[model samples]
Target: MSRRQLPSEIRKIEVLNRKTGKKVTRYELRMDAGVNQNTGQRQQVKRRYATDREARKALGEIAGGSTDGTFVGRSALTVERACAEFLAGSHSIEPTTRAAYEHALQPLRDRHGDMPVQALSKSDLDRLVNDLVVGTSPGHRRKWVANSINPMLNLISRVLADLVAQGKLTRDGAALVKRLKRSDKELQTFSEADVRKLLKHVENNRLGHAWHLAFSGMRRGEISGLLWSDVDLEDGTVTIRHNRVSVGGQVHNKDPKTETSARTLPLTPALKSALRRAENTQKVERMKLGPDYGPGEHVVVDEAGRPYHPDTLSDFWRELCVAAKVKRIRLH
Candidate 1:
């Protein structure tokens, strides 16, 4: 006698009746979910779909996911969970970029962290962007949307793409989130008189040398990260090598953002004088602090000779602007 042949292991769609024997509007898909690791027994999973085509597509995806070990049931994933997974697995991201992503994504996480990834429709994403734009001030709405909301949406979209690649999501929801057209705004700057007033006001301040470099077009981080080794008082030049950055309130020294950013900058007469004054002043501070002083090679430092936190310089600049009665501009 011939051996009995088994049927193909393909999922099937079934039409079911309600408890009252009335026909339901949707179709049900049932399939074996493979053997359970703990129980060593076959498990089953079921899904409901609005149409035969939907059922077939989902069934095909489920079968493929099982074979590839990428299967993630719809009920088992959320936006927050997906984000966490993505962040945890993204080992190649730089520290500064990762920190920016974390900060930018916080609002989205607070709003839709628990929403299911598969359930986030285009309308939902549109509503999120609209709500964020409405909540911002009229004068700053464009900036806030462009810098914060748009970046957050892009990051979420990246996470969704990772989920799709892993078979957790059928498509990226962020693809539907439209980017806003950003118009160019006039750059804010201080007048020559205001600049002179600001410089004069900071002449006696602890960050006097930093203010001089700031006016010379050196970025805040580059100024903060300066070392005596990187400065040539005789040549009146400052080399842009390292940059000190603040992320989540912590300070770190990293290389300049670009190769062009590492070029040498000529110092003005006032900057040369300021650097000399700072050098003399730090000598006195080192004498007073003795072993407690930790200036190392950094040119810009606090009273204790420790390097200044990058963000603290901005705060000081704001206060100095107020004192000088000048229009406050960003420290960068």
Candidate 2:
């Protein structure tokens, strides 16, 4: 076709091949990349592709990104570097959340860490979803359910979004990828009879007050991090101020999960009485052990007066279920 009849954004060009010293035909995609902020004039960019199809796809990305003010000139930014920078700059997230994101992004990093962010396409993301669904990705031994796979996709989406915002990516193809459909499962909870049995079994136990706190809807982490100063036995009130969560086999003491989670809660009559007994028992143990007993402000403690680890408390509850002959349910 004549130059006048050719598409405005794409055109064929001839270049000298370095090795053969012969002219080769290549398709060029040229577009208005938007005005440079440093200068008051418009900026444009050009890219050459071996095939018309490749040039057209890149043209689409540039057109969309330019229209939305998301386009920046191409560079050698790779998926691995983008992920690493995003994770490193994220300081506001909880440690547990950061750990979860790291795990979710592993597959993507392994599969496409070296791929240029500018060249990543929708088909690549789709193939990743397929591989994850069928458990065909490297290091994955079993198929992943939708619930398990969604978070990984979510992390990918977030990374892509950050890249676009930073002008490293022309557009976010990850947003076009569909999340897997999750199948719902019934939530299991303790029945009234199960609760009654558990309460009776632990009523006289050493950690009875701690069990009462769990039964009152306190999260396991909250109970593990509870301090005596945060509890008022006389006023029958408990303030939730801390949460000790396990991340990578280690526990971290942090603030409550949210602002609302740090509020005060009224203590039930049963809970109040349990707390009184626990306090008195601690006093007796302190006298018996003398200087050998460890001292702390924690409400829940072992015979040695050390605060319970969150994971250890979960294990303790599971064993308690079997001893109490009650149906097993996770103590959250």
Candidate 3:
């Protein structure tokens, strides 16, 4: 028998079988891996496999990765490490967003943290989503709706995307797993008459200014995070600079959600009047409570100046709607 020429980037080789003290044939893969940034030198890869099929499979992966400039070679990178790296390297995202990603990825970590990033398949993601939907995943005591579960899938997709960009993954496996079908629910809103009724009821309430802001289209977090300094009674303007949101039961105070979200708006006549009344009322409360008043400068607070969590504001608004005899729509 004579040796034959192997295909490009593949070579026939022989190595001693240490156990049997015999020589056995092996297929070897050799290819350029791209340049090393640190040393500015081209890199190459070489590996031997017991079979030709295995060698071809390994060659295709490396060649495809090199062609697309997304190959980082095989690694021990795990889902847990990738998620942590994504969160750590995410400097531009909001804290709430990062927290949400962490919350969403926790289940993936718990279930498949040890699995390599490249080893994760569409089936694994599908199963993970199924587990969450049925409340079988860790920490999910109740069944989750598609609307809630979809965001988790999106977060996973984002992590996978980051991995792909870093050459740790060839593609985002999460994207292949279709998002659970979300049920269509009619959006809830208040009619003019309902708005008027709530407005009339809140006119005499201590948190009237806060309700006015909500009616003016300010988000609950924007209202809760609004500082007294952000309100300009003389200029008749209010600035949206801060936003307070709760994630995992902890409240976080950060900048507005985006650049456009942090704009200054002219206050309407009714809103201005309500704000003045609120200021005076707060002053009176401060005088009564003296040192007991909350030291925070938040615009929306209780009589003792304690700032309300965004969720607390929503819960209280629902109560107010019931008392106002208006259709109790969410105060979002």
Candidate 4:
């Protein structure tokens, strides 16, 4: 019978020079770190010491720790590697959140892709903050810092926290980064008159369904994902359970952002009338197209029964605002 392989443990130690291998000034120790739970593959950890005696001592400590189940093995994992691992195993993360994390980490990957995670210092983080703040006007920089940099920092902090929980990191590098002071400018909204004007302007337009945003307080994704089945004409209520988000020009159906987001909204008079009209219009179009019409359940759809892309509503609203000579407000 074949001999069973031994469990992972310290495997080798060597004395070596920093410049040339002959003039031994330091020692390198290698240990078998056993199989990775995430990847189901063997892993190894390495450490360096100034002298062979110190290396031996450190190895003995590691062995004792391993024996007592107190060992937290050192990892040479880089930021890129950690991010990759986190994203790969994070199957429960929503698609939109995954996309946001990917976007936030792009700049960091470009700057410190190959740098070891343990080697990252506060100074390196300071440089990242400085780079973002530099080469922009004060007002624009403040807005950009608030909208972009803060979110990136927050994402990095979360990633670092996860690393600490995994025992791969001892500290969160982004914990010290302070959030930038955001401008006190409040979110702008359309007045009652503006809403009336917008509703009248789009009354005959195909995008009349957009009136739900103003009357029902539904988000853009919720509006896009709204289906006829979820609406009760008799009860005048619309149920929000799903959201359609556009990422990379593709539309995806996902759960609402929060538990509160999935709710039943009572339709106001304006919303009820608008939805009724939309239903009638879709029915007429369906009859005209006959078999050519695509079968879809969404309340907001094109002439051929294709659902609108999530971004399409925003673009349509922008054009309608321009044509109607109304102050533009973003579709929520």
Candidate 5:
């Protein structure tokens, strides 16, 4: 409503979780010096500290910066605006990664899309998480509801970290949210049998090509944008070099999910034979088209030697997974 001023508003600390007896000290940080980029209404920040010392430390951080250091006091911004900035910046990242963040943020936007940046609190975040697990939304997808909670917390962590780096908020805000842990029941990874059945189904009926690579731990885009140059036929080793991700409708190449993901995996004999057959089939089709043959060196091509979209390939993998067991090993 009205413009709020500097010297930073006071913080209130109370029980955040009555059941767990968890508590937090929160501060409504004000902007004494910095200017708001959008509304020109001066800058303000909302922060939560685990303790009084943490709160004071955050204050010193904001006060220490001359609108330029590790912290800044900015106001006149809304949660939606900050979210937009965060999402826009994530375009440089891989699509699957960006999608993960978006999945986490979706429920938050649906619930708290209207709250201003100056008024958000740790409790507000706690509520978003609580509602995600226990709240009911009629006709909503159950899987979406269940999986949406934790990553939203992670996204909040990332968003606050960015604000801290830019001097808008302090690290405490990020730190405060990261402590909200999901229950043991919330996490379910694929079982070894699940993996084996899924993989067998994929291999026998429709391996989806990329499906084989991802189950083998290849990053989605790595398998999507893979080229023959990155693979060694003689050695049967696939060296990952790049990934293609679509961010906001633009397909761009980026690095693998992690540096470690850019690795070499020996092709199984079955996989090698499959590839050989697939190539033989493609060579004949290319002849039928004669001059229409696309560029060579692209693996996992369709009947016409055309490369497949990684996203579509992902969906196909999901369906086939439902029908088949994925291969997995147990470690002692």
Candidate 6:
């Protein structure tokens, strides 16, 4: 049978079959962004109808600027645009997470700047992430590289999801994002006994305060911003509501890493007593600072009574661990 020549404005609608990995047509008419909203987030939309008369009727609605009835094809979105939107929507993300997402996109953005939304196949993205996973070794990179790669893969998938939400992509970037695996050299969490022993060993170490906080599951930033005002001394409750994070090279106060992360934990007797001693020590140091005591709000501060960089606290943690006879495993 011969095919009839279609009008110039209408076009075919395409969808990718995730299982079979092929683009198949729905045999419908589609229009570009017009005066109305259509399919996902375009200024245009695809109006599918049983006949030319119905298609023309739908087109009239689109032309007249009413998105009353139109189907959006999911392939007409771009990855770069999606990434931008994703980051914008994620302003609430912790600084660490935001930084990680930007770092994850560095490779792809450098490579696929011109990739069209409709042209990005699942395999294409999967290959990019998979290449990162299998290309490096612990000998050259850090041992937990796969762990880093997996989180970045998840971030990329999230970016693609925003595209899907905006009706830009049907594949949803799942194929590529799911293949990123955890590295074999991921951190081995210390046993409870190890945590206790580490705490006991660091009883006299500078990290004694930090050890108490980490063992209690307070994130480094939360503990760093721990204030004397939030401690319930008589009740022995440590209320965690503040966090100090560094973003774009400057430190700022932000929400806790997650909702569950900002919680009140009951201080064990050990913790309570340790906190008292630490407070006494801090007061002595502050007194010696003479005229230099700066309000005395932050519970964890340097000798100068100023908040230390959260990252520097971690370095001291490693040093304390080594001094406390804790084992350091090197995957490299």
Q: After best superposition, candidate 1 residue 150: deviation in angstroms?
A: 2.1
Over 266-318, each residue of candidate 1 has an lDDT whose tens digit, in order, gives 98999999999999999999999999999558988987888888998899888
Once superposed on the true structure, which residue ranges of model 5 sit more than 4 Å away at CA? Answer: 1-74, 86-97, 135-150, 157-178, 182-220, 245-252, 318-332
Q: Which stretches in model 6 have alpha-carbon errors above 4 Å? A: 1-82, 89-94, 136-187, 191-197, 328-332
Clashes of each: 0, 0, 0, 0, 20, 6
Question: In terms of lDDT, which candidate is stronger, 2 or 5?
Answer: 2
> Model 2, poorest ten-residue lDDT window?
1-10
- The lDDT of each candidate is 0.79, 0.86, 0.85, 0.77, 0.63, 0.68
TM-score of predicted structure 4: 0.74
Who wins the TM-score comparison?
1
Please give the distance, in angstroms, between residue 128's alpha carbon in candidate 2 and its true position after superposition: 3.0
Off by over 4 Å in 4: 1-75, 134-143
| lDDT (10s digit) by residue, model 4, range 248-305 | 7788899897899999989888778888888898899989999998875888898899
Better of 1 and 2 by lDDT: 2
Q: Name the 10 consecutive residues with the lowest summed lDDT in model 6.
A: 136-145
How does model 5 score by TM-score?
A: 0.60
TM-scores for candidates 1 onward, in order: 0.80, 0.79, 0.71, 0.74, 0.60, 0.65
> Once superposed on the true structure, which residue ranges of model 3 sit more than 4 Å away at CA?
1-73, 130-138, 141-151, 179-184, 232-236, 248-250, 264-270, 322-328
Give the Cα error of residue 164 in candidate 1, in Å.
1.5
Worst 10 residues of 4 by lDDT: 4-13
Native-referenced Cα lDDT, model 4:
0.77
Write one digit per residue (lDDT tens) for candidate 5, span 100-120. Answer: 677667766666678765567
